[model samples]
Target: MSQLRSMYPPIEPYSAGTLDVGEGYRVYYERVGTPGAKPAVFLHGGPGGGLSPEHRRLFDPNRYDVMLFDQRGCGQSTPYAGLEANTTWHLVSDIERLRALAGVDKWLVFGGSWGSTLALAYAETHPDRVSELVLRGVYTVTKAELQWYYQFGVSEIFPEKWEKFQAPIPLSERGDMIAAYRSRLTGDDRATQLEAAKAWAIWEGETITLLPNPAFSTSFGDDQFALAFARLENHYFVHDCWLEDGQLLRNAHRLRGIPGAIVHGRYDMPCPARYAYALHRAWPDAAFHLVEGAGHAWSEPGILDQLVRATDRFATAP
Candidate 1:
């Protein structure tokens, strides 16, 4: 564990369980903090990613009852990336069902990146069910954002990593990296899928973590991290995240009265700070905290501290 992890109070692992969402799908999650305390649910990023133990440290275990669940087709969830019935809408519905199963009428929604996007979507659909929101690394599935990620933004700065990311596909397919990676990742050729997964992981790892040029860890190999990642990326990118362009902000009216906070890194290369600023401008009532000298990494000292503080405030505030 990092020294930073030790600074926070120990988070005791609570119940590990699964919620059946029908169609042979099961969502797995773990609870931390006091069970009877105010409910605060965490939405992990990555349409195919799962929650990590360190993610639970964002909240003060003594003051809040924290719930972290892997979204459908990710983490401990069954039929990983099966996509038989998985969709953004299905995710929002799964949340509603989870709340009912957990017996919480309302809870704070905490998410970052893709998680933040889902949080906004859910709050828009069911504002009454959300008591508040604390979002980090906001990602609004806009075409501009997608284009930037796939072609212009990160690649502009990290050309070396970009080169590796594009090595698997020919120059002709480079223009449509998402499609190329999806076709290879979903194809019967395991070696090709693994190679694509490596590239994808390398690109993501280089950007999301603070460590410089971090090497890909094989520990997640058995976890099927690559397949799950490619599947979900294809699922979202293919459909533009199932949004009709600017749908999130256009529906911002639903969250007009909700108490919310946005924490973003000014130097973040993954999602960029511009998106956060735009969201803050749209929802002036929501507090926005931009951390200087921080990138997209959650492990950055300043960024992590701010994130935990935000959650602490939301968990304790009346």
Candidate 2:
């Protein structure tokens, strides 16, 4: 097996399942590894995006009971990006519900990028329920972070792509890329939505992975992918991730004593290492692992190895 495969070996075959979390909504989830092992839950990024098979490898199946779930309106959930009870608070409640359904008193939380933001928020609200945290490519959803992602960050690094993303919308609309995309994506004009989605995906792809191009196609040819991408991003941004200003940091007091490890790529463009540094300063007790040459892609061998190791260590600990 390749090193990547070895680090994240497939576990005992498991089946996918869904739960009715009330309000006529169902949350989709999958299980891997043994039932009696230490529980570890994976939160996917994109708010609207659901968990993928690759996410299961972050923990050692022999030692950890791994769970990957798509939040409401995401993945296999009943309504894709359905805004009803889909705020950040609702997500936290869903995690609690999932824990009870999975029959675990506490579980390790593993997340990256936007997932990391959710993990932090959830941990803050339910510190006692979290055994530990394994986070990477930390995203806080701060005003500065959003501004950087939309206006200054990727544009400074990849000006050509930035220009293409900005060209479709007028200067007045530039202040809020999320709003502009929402207008286009929800309009009656299919062509407009396609153009806007392409621009949005292109800008996101350029910064998220190490590759020069996005892993996803820009064409709205895939209805599911395009709809999920557009809807989830808009939901999170419109609500500022359902977080007040500096809420994550403000809530750090709850997580100050938690056992946690943060892994961030030094060169990550999506969520800069500076955010990781700020997190470290707040929770000085947490371990910070800096991946020198990697970007934000968790698929990178170095990041995968580090993540697996962190999970193993946390799972095996007393």
Candidate 3:
């Protein structure tokens, strides 16, 4: 078998800055690789996970001009962890703003997990502007999807972690996990919020991989990252990402001609394989990959191999 592709070597952003995207928001963006080389954009996951230097290495540094950014309140974006004017549509608009800022008529759109949801939203809204699409972990933001991760499905799989996740809210409030978390995540008690954040964040970290990844799991426990990740994620899920149930799947026709790649792990807990299968059925034009022995993280070997192949394939698309 051929070697599984991995990230290109780490490279710092050649140019980085903050853009005032209105509504008291300054979205942070960075450019890596040749400035104006084959244009592409990277959308980070978590709704608030922000960008990492590793995201820069997803593309071939010598070939693609890539943009990675912190959406709304993420990374270097303003009012750290603030959730005003932040919604699926707000983020879709942010993508358009960034695309305009890139000065390219169209560029490759790559997103994973929550990023996949945003990529679909953006591409459906502005189908004419996307040159190519690459999605990973394929979250559709449906009520069923939300329940799978936060309420019952994953809970059974990780009972101990679920116990920690459940400890934040009392028994009565447990019926609606998203609502329960949303209450404290937005509540004024700093102590309660941070406690809930760490628990909420760690749940995702602990369960996202097929096997244990201590470093990956540990980072989710960071006070700062946890707060934003848990808040943004709970906020988005509670609102169903402001999407009509099954809206993205219903609109997959918009992606039919977009030339895409959908990669989902077979054992992904947060996002089930069925949804990715549904998307594959809807958008038959894009290639579908169901990786064996992997979970949801893009960092997983099989998942990363597929992601790198997708980026490299599109790096020189016409």
Candidate 4:
């Protein structure tokens, strides 16, 4: 059996700054690893999930110069959690702008979950600019995909967690959980908003892991984190992420010539394994690894092993 790899050692950014991406949005980005090694960009998940120090450890410091950024409203970006001008395409444009700023004609694109969705959009829109693609916990945010997670499928798996997720809204609004949460998440009632936010955020935190992880779960309950996570997630889901149904899968051909890897945990709650399988079928050029005994989080052992291996394999590739 091939040995499973792990994340590279923790490292600090050699260069970091915020970029003015227009509409009053300043995206926070940083570069890590050797100054002019192979270029790669890391896209954090959640649509709302901001960049973290741990994310920088995904690529080897000696082999890659990776760009990690907080998209739009989250993290250090301006107007924290603001929704305007935050769509799938806006993010794609921001990425292109970042590329131009970095002066790299093409770079590797790595993302997980919603980040995977955004990566697909960006790659499809500008195929020539992507030298390679590495995706984990692939989530396209289709209606069926969204419903499987927020509405029905995962609910059946984690009834207890589902109950907690459903607690913020009354039984009457249970039929449309996304909309119900949206009313509160984007509402004027501060207390109720926070209540709904924690519930919404915690539900994802609780269910995403294969086993119980209190510290991981609790991080979702943080006030500011929960507010941005809950609101932005709901906003994107409510709009189906502005994606045509099955768009990412339908557009998979765009990534064919680019070297790629698709890694997914068998038990990933937020993203189903089937979609990753579907993507693999559509983009046969990419290697696919269905990790055993893992969940959606990037920290999952089996999933991380595959991701790290993919980065290492492409460290010197064109």
lDDT of 2 by residue, 154-188 (tens): 67987887898898899999888878877887777
**Per-model C-alpha lDDT, please?**
0.81, 0.80, 0.92, 0.91
Give candidate 1 misplaced runs (Cα > 4 Å).
Answer: 1-7, 210-223
In candidate 3, list every pair of residues with a backbone clash: none
Evaluated at residue 26, the lDDT of candidate 4 is 95
Query: What is the model-wide C-alpha lDDT for candidate 4?
Result: 0.91
The 10 consecutive residues of candidate 1 with the worst lDDT sum are 214-223
Query: Comparing 1 and 2 by lDDT, which wins?
Result: 1
Predicted candidate 4 versus true structure: per-residue lDDT over 1-318, tens digit per residue: 888788788899999999999999999999999988999999999889999999999998999998999998899888899999888899999999999988899999999988999999999999999999999999988888888988899999999989899888899999999999999999999999999999998998898889999987889999999999888899888898998998888988888788899999999988989999999999998999999999999998899898999999999896
Model 4, TM vs. native: 0.99
Give me the displacement of residue 182 in model 4, in angstroms.
0.6
TM-score of each: 0.93, 0.92, 0.99, 0.99
Error of 1 at 46 (Å): 1.0
Q: Write the per-residue lDDT of candidate 3 for residues 167-284, one digit (tens) a residue.
A: 9899999999889999999999999999999999989998889998899768999999999998998888888899999999999888767899999999999999999999999999
lDDT of 1 at 267: 78
Model 4 residue-pair collision total? 0
User: Clashing pairs in model 4?
Assistant: none
